[model samples]
Target: MKDLSTFFVKDNLDEIVFSNRNKAYGAYALRNEYSSQLTKALFVGVAFFASVAVIPLIVSAFSSDVITDKGHDYGPYILDPVEEIPEIVKVTPASSVPVKVKTVESTIFTPVRDVKKNKPLPTEDDKKDAALSSETSAGEDTKLIVAPPAIKVGPPTVAPPYTPPAKVEDPNIVVDGTKVDVAADFKGGINAFREKVAQNFDTESVDKTGMVSGVITFVVEKDGSISNLKVTGSSSEFNSEAERTVKAIKTKWTPAQLKGKAVRSSFRMPISMKIE
Candidate 1:
């Protein structure tokens, strides 16, 4: 309750507020020195900022001459005038002259006459030489003559006529069904043969347990007779019965043909049966 009616005071707030209170506390001392401490901090901060901004510019100014002098300078050069070289000339040699060849001389001999034949009147030159004697070493003076062409005579040419080859037949050779032009067939078709096989098969001789299967193979001869009967099966008894069944069929087969001739061909059949 001191005179709070007044708005201004000559004493600072810290001096007055803490005068009667405990000034021994650190808060009172810190409050009293705040203005001076803040002023000192502001001046130190401004000096540090100014040095950061200006130090680089001052160093660059001082070192500019050293940077310029570090590099070497090249002066303008003087070039000598160039002389033009002359072209070289080539020389050619003259050709040599050709030598001439000489010809040899020949002597001609006189001809001899046959005195036994009728003699024609001789000229004065011949008569004078003739009196020299036919015994004189001489030959007949004949001019060069061309002989007539020879005629060639021969027998007329005759070509022999062509004969066709005969067809060879070998009935002993048996060919596969696939190689023949027409495959062999049963008298009443394949199904009829299968039915005949079923009727003729004797099941009593074979084990009827589970499933039994077999393949029967035979060769149908050129004369439509079945030979070389063979059977393959899971059971030996069934195989034997199947072979016997096929052989029982006596009906002749229309034999397979090759080039319109009957040929022996192999045939295969698969037979299977199941009994509980």
Candidate 2:
């Protein structure tokens, strides 16, 4: 009994130590085996893909061949030697056409007479006979008559010469107040005529837009009326209105005065139109 129990090792401790060592060794061996297998599979896959990629290129490098004389033995060939072509001879057909031309007959004509030749002239004896006949015919003429000369007349009388009056400078000739006509002494009364024009204007179409300006020249008589109405200038759009307005004025005008007497005179009027 001295030591049967001591000689018997502890069963649980021995089993625990053996189990841990076995587990560690088995895990390490499994990891080494998996690594070796994975490396081998990767090498095999890469070698297979590389061989597959190079196979077509290697085959293409040796497949192409250029043949010259032996190319015709195959089915069909292109760009063959030019000396093998056969020569072609051209044969022209003989022409069988016959040439034909039309012929026309000619006719000759002759003139009845030759007018260019010269003829003989009358002699001196024939001229002497003709002169004697003319003298005998002149001796049988009728009698002639003559008239006497008339008397001359004297120069006619002349009328008296006309004299033009002296020119006068009048202050009233310039347009001012009620003076609507140009006087004889006035050079140009455009400003005076314009004043009268303002009083004579009449609006026809007030609805119409824009405006028109026109100048009219006419003769003014003894009475206060207008005549010979004519539009000298006007806008194209208002030409009809200008003519109508001028013609509507009275035919008699208060004449311009010179030296305290009414006299015939010329006047001009300018018309303006304004629309609202």
Top TM-score prediction, candidate number: 1
Where in model 1 is the C-alpha error above 4 Å? 1-137, 141-167
| Model 1 agreement with the true structure over 139-234: per-residue lDDT tens digits | 564444669898778997798888889877677787887888999999889999999998888888886687888888899997898999999988
Q: What is the lDDT for 174 in model 1? A: 73
Show pairs that collide, candidate 1: 111-139, 111-140
Clashing pairs in 2: 223-253, 223-254, 224-253, 224-254, 225-252, 225-253
What TM-score goes with each of the models? 0.41, 0.25
lDDT of 2 by residue, 167-201 (tens): 87654343321453335332235554444444554
**Residue 249 Cα positional deviation in candidate 1, in Å, after optimal superposition:** 1.4
lDDT of the candidates, in the order given: 0.82, 0.57
Candidate 2 achieves a global lDDT of 0.57
Report the Cα RMSD per candidate. Answer: 17.3, 21.3
